[model samples]
Target chain A: MKRGLITALAIAKKDLQTELRTKESINASASFALVILVLFSFAFDLGREELYAIAGGLLWLVFSFAGALIVNRSFARELPNDCLDVLIASPAPAWSIFLGKSVAAFFLLFIVELISLPVFGLFYNIHWTQNFPGLLLVMALATWGITVVGTAFSAVTVNIRLRELMLPVLLYPILIPLLIGAMGTTTALLQGEPMSGEAIASLRLLIGFDVIYTSLALYMIEFILIV
Target chain B: MREKAIYLLAILAALVMIPNLKTVFMDLPDEAMQGAIYRIIFIHVPAAINAQIFFTVSLITSILFLVKKNFVWDSISVSCIEVGTMLVLVNLVTGSIWGRNQWGIWWAWDLRMTSQLMCFLLYLGYLLVRPAIAEPTQRATLSAFVAIFAYADIPLVLMAIRLPNVRTQHPGPVLETGTMAKEFHAPFGLGVLAVFLICTALILIRQHQETAQREIDSLRRELHSI
Candidate 1:
C-alpha cells in the first residue's frame, strides 16, 4: 500500500511536471473560466439580489465546463506515441495511475476554481470572504467529486471516436447529482449561511457521492486500462 | 422454437393490450381530478415501469458479460438497453403530454421529472457510446462499464422522488392510494403485463438482428482478407 501510494504520487508528479512545462491545461481552464464569468455577466443583466441567488450555479457551471477541458486531457495526453501503453506496461498498478490522474486533476481544477472566485466576487460585487471557510470546503468537495468522475470518464472516452465530444456527453449526466449538491451548498454559503440544514443535506449527498464513485473508479480502472 | 416464442409473446401482449385499451377507453370513467388526461396513465405508467425493468436487466447482463466475457451476454445487454431507451422516450413524451394537460405546462423541474430526464439521457449515452468503438470486445466492455455506471442513477431517481425536501409534481404510486379506483386496477395490471411482454419481444428481436448483423460484418471482413 505504501509503495502504491508512492507510485501514485510519482505518476501525479510526472503529470504535474509535464503540465508545468506546457501550462496547457491550467492556462486553458483558468482563462476559459474567466471568459465564462465575463460571458455570464453579459448574458444576464440581473441586479444584486438575483446575482447572489444564481452565483453558486454560475460559478460551478464555469468550473464544470472549464474543468472538463482539463480532465478530458487526463488520459488523452497519454495517447500520443503510446505513452498510455507504456504507462500500463510499467510496474505501476492501474489504480495508482487512476489515482495519480485524479489527484493531478483535482489540484489543477482547485487552482482554477480559486482563481475564478475572486474575479467572480469583483464582477458580481459579492463578498465571498465572510463564508470563506465554508465556501472553500464546498469547493474542495465539489472539485474532488468532479475530478474523480471526470478522470475515470477521461479514461473511458479517450480511445473512442470523437472522444473530445463524447467525454462531456458521457460525463455530465453522471456529474449532475454532484453538481446539485455543490450548487446547493455554495449558494447557501455565498448568502452568508453556514451549515444550514439544506447545506448539511447537500454535503452528505456530496460526500456520499464522492465515496461511492471514487471506490467504483478505483475498482474498475483496471478493467478499463487492460483493454 | 425461439421464433415461436416471439410470436407467442407478441400475441399474448396483444391479447392483454386490446382488452386493456378497451377498458381504459370505454369502461373506466374519466378520473375525478385529471379527467380524460388521466387515461394516458394506462400507457405512461406501464412504459415507465417497463423501461426501468429493462434497464435493470441490461445492467445485470452487462455485469454478466464483463465477468463471463461472452458476446451473447453483450448482445442481450445492448438489446435490453435499446428497447429500454425507446420505452423511456415514450414515457417522457406521454408524461409531458399529461403534464401539459394537467399542470398547464409541458415540463417541470421537480425532482421526479428532472431525475427521469437525467435517467433518459444516461441510457441514451449508453446507446450512443456503443457505435463509437469498432472492436467487438472493446465495445462490449466499455458499454458494459457504462451500463453499470449509468445504473447508479436509477437509485438516485428513486431517492429523489422520496426526498421530503425536493418538491415533486409527479403523483405517488396511484395504485396503492385511493386516487386510482379499484376498477382501474385490473386494466393497469394488464397494461403493465402487456408492456413487459412487448418489451421482452422487442429485445429478443433486436438481439437476433444484432447477431445477424455481426455475422454479416465478420463475413465481409473475411471476404476483404481474401
Candidate 2:
C-alpha cells in the first residue's frame, strides 16, 4: 500500500512538473473562472441579502465549470504521441494512475477555487473571511469529490469522439448530490450561521460522497484504463 | 423460448393490466385530500418502481459484462437502460401532471424530483455516450463503467425524500402507512406486476435487436476485411 501511494505521488509530481513548465490548464481554468465571476455579477443584480443567500451556489457553479475545463485536459493532455498507452503500460497499477491524476486535479481545482472565493466576495460585496476555516473545509471536501469523479470520467471520455461534449454530459449528473451538499453547506457558512444540524448533515453527506466515489473510481479505473 | 417468454409476458401484462385500469379508474374511490387527480399514482408509482428495477437489471448486467467479457451481457445491459430510460420519462411526465394539479406548479426542485431527474439524465447519458465509441469491446467496457457509476445515484434517489434537511413535497409510501384504501391495494399491486412484465418484455425485445445489430456489424467488418 505504501509503495502504491508512493507511485501515485510520483505520477502526481510528474504531472505537476509538466503543468509548471507549461501552465496551460491552470491558466485557462483560472481565467475562465474569473471571467465567469465578473459576468455573474452582471447577470444577477440582486440585493445584498439575496446575493449572500446564493453566493455558495454561484461560487460552486464557477468551480464546477472551471474544474471541468481542467479535468478534461488531465487525460486529453496524454493523447498526443500516445502518452496514455505508455502511462498505462508502466509498472504502476491503474488505480495509482487514477489517484495520481485526481490528486493533481485536486491541486489545480483547489487553486482555482482559492482564487475565485475572494473575487466572488469582491463582486458580490460580501464578507466571506469571517468563517474562513469552515469555508475552507467545505471547499476541500467538495473539490476532492469533484476531482475523483472528474478524473475517472476524463479517462472514460479521453478517447471518445466529441469528448469535450461527452465529458460534461457524463459528469454533472453524477455530481448532483455532491453539488447539493456543497451548495447547502457553503450557503450556511457564508450566512454567518453556526454549524446547525442541516449544515452538519450536509457535510456528512459530502464526506460520504467523496469516500464512495473515490473508492469506486479506484476500483473501476482498471476496467476503463485497461480497455 | 425467448420469443415464447415475451409472448407469455405480454399476455400476462394485459390480463393483469385490464383489472388494474378498471380498479384504478372505476372502482377505487377518490383520495380524501388529493381527489381524483391522485389516481395518476397507479401509473406513476408503478413506472417509478419498475424504472428502478430495470436500472438494477442494467447494473447487474453491466457488471457481468465487465467480468465475463461477453457481448450478450452488454446487450442486456444496454437494453435495460433503454427501457429504464423510457420508464423514467413516464414517471417524470406523470409526476409533472400530478404536480400541476396538486402543487399549482409544473415542477419542483425538491430533493426527490431533482434526484429522479438526475437519474434520468445519467442513463440518458449512458445511451448518448454508447454510439460515440465505435469499437465493440471498448464501447461495452466504457458504458459498463458508466452504468455502474450511474447506478450509484439510485440509492440517493430512493432516500432523497426521507432526508431530514431537504424539504420534499412528495408523499411517503402510502401502503406502508396503511392510509391507502384496501381497494387501492389491488390495483396498485397488480399495476406493479403488469408494469414489470411489460418492461421485461420490452427489454428482451430490445436485447434481441441489439444482439442482431452486433452480428450485422461484425459481418460487415468481415466483408470489408475480405
Candidate 3:
C-alpha cells in the first residue's frame, strides 16, 4: 500500500513537473477564460445591480469552459508524448494512476479558479473577501467530481476520431448535477444570501458525487486503460 | 424457444390491455381546471412507467455485463437503452401535449420533465459513444464503463430537479404518492410488466442477430485469408 502511494505521488509529480516547464496549457486556458469573461461583461453591459445579480452564473460559465479546456489538454498531452502507455504498463496499480491524474488536474483547475475569482470580482463589482473561502471550497469539491469523471471519459474519447469535439459532448450531460450544484451554491454566496438548507444540501450532494465518481473511476480505470 | 413464447405472450398482453386502457381513460375524474383534457394520463402514465422499466433493466444488465464479462448482457444493455430512449421521447412529447391543454402553454420546464429529459440525454450519449469505437472488444468495454457511469448519475439528476430553488410546474413527490397514486396503480402495474416482457423479447432477438452477424463476418474474413 505504501509503495502504491509512493508510485501515485511520483506519477502526479511527473505531471506537475512537465506542466511547470511547458506552461502552455495553463497560460492558454487562463487567457481563454479571461477573454470569455471580458466578452460576456461587454455583451451584457448591464447596470451595476443587474451585473451583480448575474455575476455568479457568468463566473461559473467561464470556469466551466476553462475547466473543460484544461481537462482536454491534459488528456491530449498524454497521447502525443506516449506517456499514457508508460502509465498503463507500469507496475503501479491502475487506481493509483487515476488518483494521481485526478489530483493533478484538480490542482490545475484550482489555480485557474484563483486567477478567475478576482477577475470576476473586478468586472462585476462584487465583493469576494466574505465569500472567498466558501466559494473556494465549493469550487475545489466540484472540480474534483468533474475531473474524476472527466478524466475517465477524456481517456475514452482520446482514442476516438474528432476527440476534442467528442469530449464535451460526452461529458457535459453527465456532469449536469455538479454544474447545477456548484452554480447554485456560488450564486447564493455571491448574492450575499444566507446559505439555506437547500444550498447546504447541494454542497453535500456535490461531496457525495465526488466520493462516488472518484471511487468508481478508480475501480474502472484498469479496464479502460487496458482495452 | 421459451424466450420467443414469452415475447408472443407479451404481445398478446399489450393487445388485451388496450381496451382496458380506453375504459380507464373514459372513467378518469375531471380535474377542476382542465376538465376532460386530463385524460391524456392514459398514454402518458404508461409511457412514463415503461421508460423507467427500460432504464432499470438497462442498469441491471449493465451490472451483469461488468461482472460476467458476457457480450450478450452488454448487447441487451444496449437494446434496453434504445427502447428506453424511445419511451422517454414519447413520454416527453405526450407530457408536453398534456401540459398545453392544462397549463395553457405548450411546454414548461417542470421538474419531472427536466429530469426525464436529462435522463433521455444521458442514454442518448450512451448510444452515441457505443458505435464510435471500431473494435468490438473496445466498444463493449468502453460502453460498459459508460453504462455504469450514466446509471450512477440518475440519482444526482433526480436530486437536482427536486431542489427547491429550481422552479417547475410539475406536481411534487406528494402529489405522485397521494393524489394520483391510486388512480395510476392498476394500469401502471400491468403496463410495467407488459413492457418489461416486450423489452426482454426485443433485446434477445437483437442480441441473437448481432451474434449471428459477428459469426458470418468472421467466416468471411477466414475465407478471404485462405
Candidate 4:
C-alpha cells in the first residue's frame, strides 16, 4: 500500500512537472474559466441580487467546464508523447496511474477555482473572505470527485473522434449530481447561512459520491488502459 | 428466418396489447385536478416501462460483451442500445404530450423524464462513439468500456431527479403506487415483457446478420489479397 501511494505520488509529480514546463493546459483552463465568468456576468447583467443568487452556480459551472477541458488535454498530451504507453508498460499498478492522473486533475481544477473565486467576487461585487474556508473545502471535495471520474472517462474518450466535443457529452450527465450537491452547499455557505442540516446532508452526499466514483474508477482504469 | 418469425410474433403481441391499453385509459374516472385527458397514463406508463426494459437490456448485454468478448455479443449490445434509444425517444415525446394535456405545458423538468432523457443521451453517445473508430477490436473494446461506464450514471440520474428538492412537475412514486398501480398493472407488465422479448429477438437477429456480413467482408478481403 505504501508502495502504491508512492507510485501514485510520483506519477502525480511527473504530471505537475510536465505542466510546469509547458503551462499549456493550466493556462488555457484558467483563461477559459475567466472568459466564462466574464460572459456570465455580462449575460446576467450582474445586478446585485441576481449576481449574489447565482454566484455559486456560475463559479462551479466555469470550474467544471474548465476542468473537463484540462483533463482532456492532459491525457491527450501524454498519449502523443508516448508518456502514457510508457507508464502502462511500467511496473506501477494501473490504479496508481488513475490516482496520479486524478490528483493532477484535482490540483489543476483547484488552481482554476482559486483564480475564479476572486474574479467572480470582483465582477459580481460579492464578499468572499467570509466564506473562503468553507468554499475552499467544498471546491476541493467536489473537484476530487469530478476529476476521478472525469480523468478516467477523458482518457477513454480522448482516442475517439471529435474528442473535445465528446468529453462533455460523456461527462456532464454523470457529474450533475455532484454539481448539484456542490452548488447547493456553496450557495448556502456564501449566503452566510448556518450550514443547515440540509447543507450537511449535501456535503455527505458529495463525499459518498467521491468514495463510490473513485473506487469504481480505480477498478475500471486497468480495463480502460488495456482496451 | 427464425429471427424474422420472432420479430413477427413480437409485432403481433404489440397489436394485441393496444386494445387492453385503450380500455384502461377509457375506464379512468375524471378527476378534479387532471380531468379526462389524464387518460394518457395508458401510453405514458407503458412507454416508461418499455424504456426501463431497454436500459436493463443494454446494461446486461454490455456485461455479456465484456465477459464473452464475442463479436456476436458486441453486436447484440449495440442493437439493444439502438432499440433502447428509440424507445426512450418515444417515451420522452409521448410523456411530453401527456404533460401538455395534464399540466398545461409541453415539458417539465420532472425527475422521471429528465433521468430517462439522460439515459437516452448516454446511449446516443455510446452509439456515436462506436462507429467513429475504424478498427473492429478497438471499437468493441472501447465501446464495451463506455457501455459499462455510462450505465453507472442511470442510477445517479434517477436519484437526482427523484429528490424532493428538485421541484419537478411529474407525479411522485406515491401517485404511481396508489390507484394508478392497479390501473397500470396488467398492460404495463405485458408491455414491458412484450418489449423486452421483442427487443431481445430483434437484437439477436441483427447480431447474426452483422456477424455474417463481417465474415463475408473478411473473406472478400482475403481473396483480394490472394
Candidate 5:
C-alpha cells in the first residue's frame, strides 16, 4: 500500500514534470478559459444581479470546458507514441496511474480556476465570500469529481478517431449532478448566507460525487488504459 | 420455445391493448377536471412506464454482461436500450402533444418532464458513443461502464429535476394516492400490462437479431480464413 502511494505520487510527479517542461495543455486550457471569459463578459454583460444569479453555472461552464480540454490533452503524449503501453508495462498498477494523472489534472484545473475566477469577478463586478474555507472545500471536491471522470474518459478516448467530440457527450451527462452540486454550493456561498442546510447538502453531494466517480474511475481506468 | 414465448407475448399484448383502447375511449368516464381529452393517459403513461422499465432492463443486463462477459447479455442490453429509446421518444411526443393542448404550453420545467427528457438524452448518449471505439471488447466494456452510470443517473436526474420552484404538470403515481379512480383502474392496469408485454417482446426480437448478426459476422470471418 505504501509502495502504491509512492507509485501514484511518482506518476503524478512525472505528469507535472512533463507539463512544466512542455506547458502544452495547461497553456491551451488556461488561454481557452480566458478567451471564453472575455467573450462571455462582452455578450452577457450581466450586471451584479444577473451575474450573481448565474455566476456559478457560468464559472462551471468555462471550467468544465477548460477541464475537458486539459483532460483530453492529459493522455495526448502517452497515446501517440505507444508510450501508454510502455507506462502500463511499468511497475505501477492501473489505479495508481489513474490516480497520478487525475491528481495532476486536478491541480491543472485548479490553476485554471485560480486564473479564471478573478477574471470572472472582475468582469461581473461581484464579490462576497463569508465562507472562504467552505468555498475552497467545495471547489476542491467539485474539481476532483470533474478530473477523475474526465481523466478516465480522456484515457478511454485518447486514441479514438473521433478526437475531441467524444468527451462532451460522455462527460456532460455524468457531470450534471456534480455541476448541480457545485452550483448550489456556490450560490449559497456567494449570497453571504451562513452554511445553511441546502449549502451543506450541496457540499455533501459534492463529496458523494467525489467518492462515487473517483472510486469508479479508479476501478475502470485499468480496463480503459490497457488497450 | 423462447421464440414462441415472444410471439405469445406480442399477441397477448395486442389483445390487451385493443380492449384497453376501448376502455379508454368509450368505457372509462371522462376525467372530472380534464374531460375526455385526458384519455391520452391510457397511451402516454404506459409508454412512459415502459420506457423507464426497459432502461432498467438494460441496466440489469448491462451489469450481467460485465459480470459474466456474455454476448447474450450484451445483446439484451443493446436491445432494451433501443426499445427504451423508442418508447421514451414516444412518451415525449405524446406528452408534448397532450401538454400543449391541455396545459397551454408544449414544454415546462416540470420536474418529471425535465427528468424524463434527461432520461431520453441519456439513452441517446449511449447510442451515440458506441461507434467511437472500433474494438469489440473495448466498446462493450466502455458501454457497459456508461450503461451503469446511465442507469444510476435516472434517480439523480429526477432529483435534480425536482426543483422547489417548479410545480409538475405530470400527476403522481395512481397507486401512490391510495385509489385508482374505480373505472379507470381496469384500463390503466391493462394498458401497463400491454405496454410491458410489448416492451418485452420487442427486446426479445431485437436481441435475437443482434445474436444472429453476431453469428453471421463470425461465420464470415471463418469463411474468409478457410
Candidate 6:
C-alpha cells in the first residue's frame, strides 16, 4: 500500500515534469477555456443580468470541455513513447496509475481554472466577494469529480480507433450530474445567496459524485486496462 | 424453439396493441386536465416503460456476461441497446409533443424528462463506443462494463435530478400507488404487456441473428486458415 502510494505520486510527478517540459496539455486547455469564455461572453451580449445568470454555466462549460481536451492529450502523450505501457508494467497496480493520472489532471486543470476564472470574472464583472470561500470549495469539489472520471475515461478511450471522438462521447454524459451540481452551486454563489438548501443539496451531490465515481473508477480500472 | 416463441410473441403483441390503440382512442375518456392530448399516453407510457425495462435487461445481461464470460449474454445486451434506444427516442418525441400541448413548450428540463434524456445519451454513447474498439473480447468487456456503470449511476443521477425538482411537468409514478381505477387499468395493462412482449421478441430474434452471424464469421476465419 505504501509503495502503491509512492508509485502513484511518482507517476503524477513524472506527468507534471513531462507537462513542464512540453506545456502541451496546459497551454491547450487554458487557451480553449479562454476561447469558450470569450465566445459565450459575446453571445450573451444582450444584458448584464443575463450575462451574470449564465456565467456559472459558461465557466463550467469551459472547464468541462477544456478538461476533456486535457484528458485526451495527457493519454495521447503517453502513446508516442509507450510510457503508459511502462507504467502498467511497473510494480504498481493499474488503479494506482489511475490515481496518479487523476492527481496530475487535477493540478493541470486547477492551473487552467486559476488563470481562466479571473478573466471570466473581469468579463462578466463578477463580484468574487460573494461567498468566495464557498465558490472556491465548489470549484475544488467539482474539478475533483471531473478529474476522477476524466482520468479513468482517458485510459478507456486512449486505445480506440476514433480515440479523440470517443473521449467526449463517453465522458460528458457521465459528467452531467457533476455539472448540474457545480453549475447550481456556482450560480447560487454568484447571486450572493447564503448556502441555502438547494446549494447544500448540490454540494452534497458533488461530494457524493466524487466518492462514488472515484471508488468505482478505482474498482473498475483494472478491468478497463485488461488489454 | 426460442425463435419460434419470439415470432409467436411478436404476433400476439401486434394483436394486443390493436385493441390497446382502440381502447386508448375510442373507449377511454380523455384525461380531465389535458383533454384529448393525453391520449398519447397509450404510445408514450408503454414505450417509456419498455425503454426502462430494456435498459435494466441490458444491465442484468451485462453483469451476467461479465461474470460468465458468455458471448450470448453480450448479444442480449446489444439487442437491449438497440431496442431500448429506439423506444427512448419514441418516448422523447411523444413526451415533447405532449409537453408542447400542456406547457406550451417543446422541452422542459424536468427531473423525469431529463433523466430519460441522460439515459438515452448513456445508451447512445455505449452504441457509439462499440465500433471504436476493434478487438472482440475487449469490446465485449468494455461495453458490458459501460452498461453496468450506466445502470449503477442511474439512481444517483435520479437523486440529483430530483434534488431541485423545479419543474414537475410529468406525472409521478402510477403503478406504485396501486389505487388505479379499474377502467383505466385494463387498457394500460394490455398496453404495457404488448410493449414488453414486443421488446422481448425483438431481443430474442436479434440474439439468434447475432449467434448465426458469429458462426458465419468464425467459418470465414476457418476457411481463410485452411
Clash count in backbone of candidate 4: 0
Per-residue lDDT over B101-141 for candidate 5, one digit per residue giving the tens place of the 0 to 100 score: 88889998777677777787777888888777665677777
Instruction: Write model 2 residue lDDT over B18-56, tens digit each, in one string.
Output: 978987888788888888998898899899899988899
For candidate 2, the docking band is: medium
Once fitted onto the true fold, the runs of candidate 2 whose alpha carbons sit more than 4 angstroms away are: B157-165, B172-178
> What is the per-residue lDDT of model 6 for residues A124-226, given as tens digits with 9 covering 90 to 100?
7887667889988999999999888888878778888988888899888888888988997898788888998999999999999999888888888887776
Please give the lDDT score at residue A161 for candidate 1: 95
**Alpha-carbon shift of residue A64 in model 3 (angstroms):** 1.7
Docking class of 4: medium
Cand. 4 Cα-lDDT: 0.77
Off by over 4 Å in 3: A194-196, B6-10, B24-33, B172-176, B180-185, B216-226
Model 5 over residues A170-199: C-alpha lDDT tens digits?
A: 888878877887887787677676777777
| CAPRI accuracy category, model 6 | medium
Tens digit of per-residue lDDT, candidate 1, span B1-226 = 8799899999999999998898889988987777787999889989988988988898899889889998899999999989888888898899899899888999988775777788889988888888998877788889888998899866654543343376667677643364666788899899999999998998899999888988887898899999
Q: What is the interface RMSD of candidate 6, in Å?
A: 1.3
TM-score, cand. 6: 0.93
Clashes of 6: 0
DockQ rank order: 6, 3, 2, 1, 5, 4
Q: Quick one: best lDDT, which candidate? A: 2
Off by over 4 Å in 1: B157-164, B172-179
**Model 4: residues >4 Å from true position, as ranges?**
B1-5, B11-15, B18-36, B162-164, B172-176, B181-184, B209-226
Off by over 4 Å in 5: A128-130, B1-3, B162-166, B171-178, B219-226
How close to the true structure is residue B33 of candidate 2, measured as C-alpha lDDT? 89
TM-score of 3: 0.91
Better of 1 and 5 by DockQ: 1
The TM-scores of chain A alone, one per candidate, are 0.98, 0.98, 0.94, 0.96, 0.95, 0.96
**Using Cα atoms with residue i matched to residue i, what is each candidate's TM-score against the true structure?**
0.96, 0.96, 0.91, 0.90, 0.93, 0.93
Candidate 5 lDDT score at position B200: 92
Candidate 4 lDDT tens digits, B71-187? 877777777777778878877887888787778898878677778778888888888777776656677777777777777777766655553376767666534754544655676
